[model samples]
Target: MGKTVKLYVHWVDTFNRWVGRFAMRLIFVMAAIMLYAIFSRLFLGRPVNWVMEMSQFLLVSYYLLGGAYSMQLDAHVRMDLFYGRLSAKKRAVTDAFTILFVIFYLGVLAWGGFSSTEYAWSYNQKNYTSWAPPMWPVKAIMTFGIILMLLQAISAFFKDVAIARGRPIA
Candidate 1:
């Protein structure tokens, strides 16, 4: 049992590290986009056509993709003072409820976001600028990110259940 837990922990750690790397890369990608936009505006006669919106889209994508990584590491913000003192079963219950609440919220976000994205796509959405691209692709980020975040939350809640059952979370 210990060996199995250790193997799972090792795998989880590997996944955590991989996701961290990707998150960092996304950060750099956003920064590069901003710099390029600034350079284009400063050095060229034309400013970056859609850089601001593109950067924002990249950032949303990063947060959605990076959320699971944060959850895996137990790095997310939570008020855990009493939580640490709770019995394992109690802790599991709390964790489960918390995640269920999050799931509800994410479900709302996903539904609404999907509707907006669909509307945009169906209408051949465009930006306000001359280089306007279809806005649906950008809008889709909300749905994707929220869904992924909800999945990670569900996974973490189950992890707590496992822990309460005397099984290792990993």
Candidate 2:
């Protein structure tokens, strides 16, 4: 309800929205590239060597970047069998508790990812393919994505905690 908290929520939501929009648009690009690769290989009889690697990286980036946005929408999978039966306050409490585990898991992921990205950057690691794309960018994106997911989780946890306490989330 406070101005600061509201501002933060708006900021987070806005960032996720932008990311989601970019990712969605990138899907079209991915499709176009795939079509071109397929057509060129089949018709022109010359396979594009970089196409596979590029597509793989783009797919990874798409999912990683869209994770926080999906979380914001609560689009991630969950077992609805028992969860669906819970009261609102109880569900909120359960969600808050469940997120504790997620926080710990993402903490470890972010730490390891950051270290890996740093090593990649320092060594200038590259893929074994002829394209030999630098690995640091994707690794860095992984770390950044995990951080974004963590922030989204924290926001959700706060909202759930408020709901569990019967507070109106203004």
Candidate 3:
């Protein structure tokens, strides 16, 4: 039998890593804006809409991008009572099953998210407010983030399978 590669999932991992790391830099930007907003509100007695809006946008990207990273590090919220107590072999089996479930879950999310992104892009969508920026770009990030999560799940599924079988993983 030929060795099969999950290319789509791999690409998802690559994309997720890139975007996740890139999003980290935005923290500084958000902090700077936050300081400014605080200063403006506390001293100047006024808050700028653009700063608030931009912060919201940056936060959206930060969280979406971090989703896959959290998955990569196994940091997502989960009930771990059974998972935490399992033996190595049992854990591997559970891991495989869990990853499989995530694959399907994230698969659907990516599908719908991508379609949503496409719909927004097709209409040349923009935020319905002053300083209207194109929204499709942000939507695109959402879809891409989900895709990366799905891909990481696939690779993890294979990893758990290999571990369960007492085989070395590549």
Best by lDDT: 2
lDDT of 1 by residue, 45-137 (tens): 677777877888788878876776787677899887799998878888788778888878888888998999999999998987777878888
- Candidate 3 contains a number of clashing pairs equal to 0
**Each prediction's TM-score versus the true structure:** 0.78, 0.92, 0.80
Off by over 4 Å in 3: 1-18, 39-47
Candidate 2 C-alpha lDDT tens digits along 1-170: 46676677677878987887787676777888899999999999988888887788788778878898999899999989899999999999999999989988888999999999999999999999888999999898888888888878877887788789888465
Model 1, position 160, has a per-residue lDDT of 70
Q: Would you list the C-alpha lDDT of every candidate in the order shown? A: 0.75, 0.85, 0.78
Give the lowest summed-lDDT range of ten residues in model 2: 1-10
List candidate 2 stretches off by more than 4 Å: 1-3
CA lDDT, candidate 3, residue 140: 84
TM-score (C-alpha, index-matched) for candidate 3: 0.80
Better of 1 and 2 by TM-score: 2
Q: Model 2, 24: alpha-carbon shift in Å?
A: 1.8
Question: Candidates ranked by lDDT, best first?
Answer: 2, 3, 1
